[model samples]
Each structure stands twice: as C-alpha cells, then as structure tokens.
Target: MSWLVTGGAGYIGSHVTHAMCDAGIPVVVIDDLSTGFAEFVAPAATFVEGSLLDGALVEDTLRRNGVRGVIHVAGYKYAGESVNRPLHTYEQNVTATLTLLSAMQRAGVEAIVFSSSAATYGTPDVEVVDESTATTPESPYGETKLIGEWLLRDVGRSAGIRHTSLRYFNVVGSGSPRLFDASPHNLFPKVFDMLYRGETPRVNGDDYPTPDGTCVRDYIHVADLALAHVAAARRLDDGLPVERVYNLGSGAGTSVAQIMTAIRTVTGIDFEPTIMPRRPGDPARIVATGDLAARDLDWTMRHSLEEMVSSAWEARRQAGDTYPR
Candidate 1:
C-alpha cells in the first residue's frame, strides 16, 4: 500500500513526497495545482490532479492507489491575506480537511501527518512555545489551521485514526533546486525578489526588544521539516508512540537583523537592509521548543542560519520568475 500525499506538488508537500520515496515507500499524490506547480511532483510518485473538496476524487485516489496513510499538506496558507478572504480560508483549510478526513475514514486509511502552522498561537506570551501553548490565532488562516487540528483529534477519537500535527513557523530554505518557496508572503522569497530586482530589502521593524532590536522568529529548513514528517509516518507505520502535536523549531531563533546579515554574506551583496516602521502587533520574539520532536519525531536543525540563507538563495536564483511574478 502507498502513502497518499495531498498537495504533493507544493514546496513542502513535494519535499515530503520525495523524502517518503527515498525511504523506499510507494507514494501517490493528489494536488489541484492551484498554488503548487505540477512539475514539482516527483516522477517516482503517482500524481492525481484534483481538489480536496472533491470527496469522491480524494476517495478514489486513496482506493485506487491502495493508500494506507495520508500526509495532508494542502491549504490556503497566507495569514495576512486571509483577513480579506476568511470564507475562502475556512473553506480550504477547514471544510476541505473535513472532506479529507471523511474520505479517509470511509477508505479505512488510519494514519496521517498533518502540516500545521505556529500561527495557531497568536502572539504567544511565552518566549518559547511547546505543544501545551494556548491557541489564540490572530488570523483566519491560523484559525483554520487550529480548527483542522481539532477535526483531526475529533475524528481520531471517533474512528481510532492515528495522527499528529507538526506546527512550525517561518519555513524557509529548500531541499533541492527543483523546489523553492513560492509564496509571495514568505520572507525568503520576498527578500530574494527584492534583492533580485536590485531593490534593497526592508526590515519592517528594528526597535523591538530583541537582542538585535528586531523580531526573532524560527526559520526551519524545508528538508529538516520534511524529514520530521517522514519520521512521524514511519512511527505511525511501525505502531510506535507519537505525540498529538510536535513543534518543529530551533529553540533559539534567528532575528530579522541576523537574516539580513546572512543574506548579505550568502548573496555576496554589500547592501545594508533598509529599516521601516513597525507593523502593528509584531512581536519582539517568538520561538518554540523542539525537545519533544527531538525525542519522538527525529527533528533537528540540520542547517545553520548561513546554510539556510545560502540554500534558499540558490533555489530562488534557480526559480527566477517562479519566485515572484
């Protein structure tokens, strides 16, 4: 039986699909190619172009491929933009996930690894967040993600499905040149687009209480995140214990200033970042503890700040127009 990876054409999902294939697992992908590119899906995996909203299509894909598990990474992921489109966000992230879970139950696929976001904790008061942190999402995007988690838990209780969600913040870098961050809202691609167009990168705020007077945020390499998903899947397959949720993070995070310095060094650019006024509700620092993940999900920060910048820069340069259109 194969593993079904929804949105396997997306940056994170594509990496997970390829990583699962690397582990000698047969993989089947279901993606609508909405924001994701069809080219990103690995040839080794069977690809089905469809939406998660189409329950019959999803169930057909699962049954046709003899899928034993699911890795759900499909959703509308822009937090700020979600404010203007809450209905779309809820439909894609919540309603779509419900459809997926229902189909999985009907098909008897009992395992899943959900791709979640740290945005679930809206401006957390704690310096370092763990699974126990309160979820007070500040945006529709985040609210939907938390709702997705609740759906998973409720379904697990009713159907005995084995599942876990990995909550992460500021996912950056790339696993390969073939894959790169494509979101217009993501920091890496946003910075790369600015620099590539010979424009100076702007720091939104620099007067925060962080060590460098800029926001300190966790930015994990996509490959590291993908590996954690692989570990979660393997444990579920092997009937090993796994947590309800894992925070994929580096305990100590990189600040905006640190990111600027790394970009300057990696791209061989001698430009200093331009500073602007702070955006409202911007926190000084928000990081997460990966101790639980390290113990159970094989999570680790395999790339340093410099390595993350370099790898992301290379992939963005390779992506060209794919970065920002």
Candidate 2:
C-alpha cells in the first residue's frame, strides 16, 4: 500500500515526498500545478495532476493506487494575502480539506498526517506556546487551518480514522539543490529574489520590542519538518499511539533582522535591509516548544540558521533563470 501526499509538487510537500521515498515508502503525489512544479515531485512517486477539490478525482486516486494513508499539504498558504482573499482561502483550505476527508472516508483510507501551521496560534501571548495554547487565529488562512484540524478530530472520533496535525512554524531551507521554496510571500524566497535582481531586501516593522526591533519567528528546516511527517505516518502505519496535534518547532525565536543578517553572511551579499512600517496584525514574537514532537516524532532542529539560509540560497541560485519571478 502507498501513501498519498497531496500537493506533493510544492516546496514543503516535495521535500516530504523525497523523505518518504528515501525511507522506502511508496508514494503517490496529487497536485494541481497552481503553485507546484511537476519536476519537483520525486521520480519514484506516481504523479497525479489534479486538485483535492475534485472529490471524484481524489476518491479515484485513493482507490486506484491502493492508498492507505494521506499526508494532506495542499492549500492557499499566504497568511497576509488571506486577509484580502478570505473566500479563496476558505475554499482552498477549508472546503478542499472537507472534500479530501469525505473522499478518504468513502475510499476507506483510515489515516492522515495533516500539514498544519503555527498560524493557528496567532499572536499568542505566551513566550513559548505548546499544543495547549488557545487557537485564536487572526487571519482567514489560519482560521481555515484550525478548521482543518477540527475536521480531522471529528472524523477520527466518528470514523475511527487515525490522524495527527503537525502545527509547524516558519519552514525554511532546501533539502536538495533542485527543490526550492518558490513562494513570493515567504521571507527566505523574497529576500533571495530581491538579491538576485540586485534590489534591496525589505523588512517590515523594525520598531518592535524584539532584540533587533523586528518580528521573532520560530524557523524550522523543511527537511527536518519532512522527517516528522514521515515519523507520524509510520506511527499510523504501525498502529502506534499518536498525539492529536504536535508542534514541530525549534523552541527558539529568530527575528527578521537576524534572518537578513544570516542571509547576508550566507550569500556574501553585503546589503542592509530596507526597514518599513509594521504590517497590520504582525506579532512581535511567536515561538513554540517542540517537546512533544521530540518525544513522539524525533523532532529537532537539525539545521542552524546559517544552513537554512545557505541551503535556500544555493537552491535559489541553482534555479537561476527558472526560478519563478
């Protein structure tokens, strides 16, 4: 039996696919090329070009591929942009997840590892958040993700579907030179893109209470994040107990300014970032403890800030002209 990785052609999803493939897990990837590149998918994994919104296609893929579990990762993931595109976010993240769960039930697929987000704990007041933190998502994208977790919980209760949601923090770095994060909204790609074009990187809000007067975020390498997903999937496959939710975090915070410095050092690009006004709804700091994930999924920050920057920069440089504008 194979595992189905939805959105397996995207940055994080592709890394997960590679991790699974490397671990000898047969994988089937279904992705709509909206934001994913087909070439990013692992060569060993079967590729299905479609959207999870298509219930018929999803169910068909499950039945035809002997799929036993799912790693649901596809969604409209821009937290800031979701403010102006609430409907699109909900449709993609919420409704599409509903469709996927319904399809799984019909196809008798009994396990799922959801690709959740730290956005679910928007602007948490605590210095370090755990799974017990209150989920008061501040954006439509965050709301959709929290809703996705709720759906999985309810489904697991009624249908006996084994599941776990990995609420990871800012995922950065590239596992391979060929697989790069191409998001126009994420920090790493944005700065790298600006540098490639000989433009100054912009940092929003440098007047915060942080050490460097910028937002502090917990950054985890995409490769490390992928390993946790595989561990959760294996736990499901082996019928081992799994938590309802786990935070795949670094247990530390890095400010935007620090990230820029790391980028500068890694890329050997000496340029000060252009500081801008604070974006609305921006949190000063949000870090989480990965104690639970560490205990259960062998989660840990395997890469340092330098590695995160250097790897991403290497991949961005490798992409060269093909890197999405």
Candidate 3:
C-alpha cells in the first residue's frame, strides 16, 4: 500500500518521504511547490505537482496512486507571518486540509498522520508542555494547525478514519546533505546564512530568566521528527492503537545563547552574536516533555545541538545558492 505525503517537496515533508521510502514503504508525493522546491522530492516516489486546494487533483492523486494512507504536511507554516495574513493562512492550512480529507474519504483512505505544531499551545504558564497542554493558539498559523487537528478528530469520529497529529517544537538540522531547512524565518538558516557571509549572528535577547539568560525552546532534528512520523504511520498501518495527538519534543530545551554558542563552535566563527531586545511577548522558556511520544511513537532527541548545527551547515553548503535566501 502506498502512503501519500502532501508537501513532500518541503523540508520536513521531503525528509519524511525519504524516511518512509527507506523503510521499503511505497510512497507518493503531492506538492504545489509554493514554498517548496521541486528538486527536493525523491525520484523513487510517484510525484504529483499540485495544491491541496485543488480537490479534484487531490482525489485523482489518491485514487491513481492507490494511497492507503496520507501524511498531511502541507500548510502555511509561518506563525509570525500568519498574523499578518490570516485569511491566506486559513485558506491554505484549514480549508486546504478539508479538501484533502474529503478526497481521502472519497478514496476510502482511512489513515492519516497530520503535521501539527507546538504553536497550538501558544504561551502557557507551564514549565514543560505535554499532550494535555491548554491550546490557546496566538496566531493564525497556530489556529490553523489546531483546526486541522479538530478536523481529524471530528472526521475520525464520524468516518472511522484512524488518524494522529504530531505536534512538534522547533524543527532543525538535516538528515541528508541533499536536504536542508530553507525557511527564512528559521533560526538555523538565519545563522547559517550570516556565518556563511562572514557576518555575526544576532540574538533577540539574552536577559531572559534562564540558566543561559536566554529563551529556551525544544529543538528536534529533522531526521528525528521524520522517524516519529514513520513510527506513527507504522502504528496505524499495523492496526496498533495510538493517541490522537503526540508531542514530538525534547524533555529539556536549548537556549538561544546555547544555540549561538553551538553555532559559533561549529562554524568556527570567532565573533559573538549581537544581543537585541526581546521581541514583544516573547517567552523566556517553553519546552515540552515527550514522555508519551517516547512510550508510543519512538520519539527521542537523537541529535545533539552540535550535531544539528553541523548537519545543517553541511546541507546548506551543499545547496549553495540553491538554498533559499
């Protein structure tokens, strides 16, 4: 049975496709290439270049590929920008997901692994978030992610479709030199670009209430995240019971200063980062405990900060200018 991975040309999605196919699972990819590159998709999979908004194309892709399940990773993923463009965010993430679900139901596809985000939790007054953290999303992007989860929950109850949502913290690093995170808003790429250009990386704040005097966040390797997706999918494929939502994260988190130190160490940059004032409403700390995921979905922080930085650097160098600026 073939598994359909939407947005398979994207950074995380492409990595997910690679992980699944490496396990000898048949895979099919559908991506519009809006923010994704067509070159990132693996040639082994049957690829369809299209958007989830195109209902007919989605249905056709599912039916044609005989997809038994879907890994719904397609969405407008920028949280900060979603605040400025809420309509576009909802249309792409929420409405587009509805379209995909409709096609899945029509094609008798009953299993899905939704790519949810930690943004669904917003800023909570908790030390470490778990699956049960209160979901009060602060941005359109986070709201859309929550709505996608709601869609899966409601649809599952009504249609008997087995599904799960993997809500993760900061996703960084690359599994292969051929694949790297190309997001402009992401920390890894930003620092990578600066160092490559012989510029000092900038840290937003360094006076937060933390050991390192910087905000702390869970940072998981892209490869580790991909492995969790495969594990979740495997559970569904084997008819094993799994939770509706799993938080893929590190129990503890790395601070911005810690990250900067790692980046400097890895890149051989002698300069320290410039510390600017914290952005409005930026929390000092927000980490999650992946105990549930660890028990069920084989989730773990398999890569260290140094490893994450090194791998990302290697991939960015490999991509050269082809990587997004």
Q: Determine which window of 10 residues in candidate 3 has minimal summed lDDT.
A: 316-325
| C-alpha lDDT (0 to 100) for residue 22 of candidate 2 | 99
- Enumerate clash totals for all models, in the order shown: 0, 0, 0
Tens-place lDDT digits, model 3, residues 1-325: 7999999999999999999999899999999999888878887888899889999999999898889999999899999999999999999999999999999999999999999999999998898999888999999999999999999999999999999999997999999998888898999999898878888889998888899888999999999999999999999999999999999878889999888888878877788888898998788998989999999988888898999999999999998987674
Q: After superposition, how far is residue 164 of candidate 2 from its true place, in Å?
A: 0.3
Candidate 2 residues 16-61, lDDT tens each?
Answer: 9999999999999999989999999999999999988999999999
Error of 2 at 21 (Å): 0.4
Residue-by-residue lDDT tens digits, candidate 1, 1-325 = 9999998999899999999999999999999999999889988999999999999999998899999999999999999999999999999999999999999999999999999999999999999999999999999999999999999999999999999999999888888987888898888888899999999988998889988899999999999999999999999999998899999989999899999989998999889888999988888999999999999988999989888889889988998875553
Q: Each candidate: what lDDT? A: 0.92, 0.95, 0.92
Stretch of 10 with least lDDT, candidate 2 = 248-257
Error of 3 at 295 (Å): 1.0
lDDT of 1 at 7: 89
Give me the runs in candidate 1 sitting further than 4 Å from their true place. Answer: none
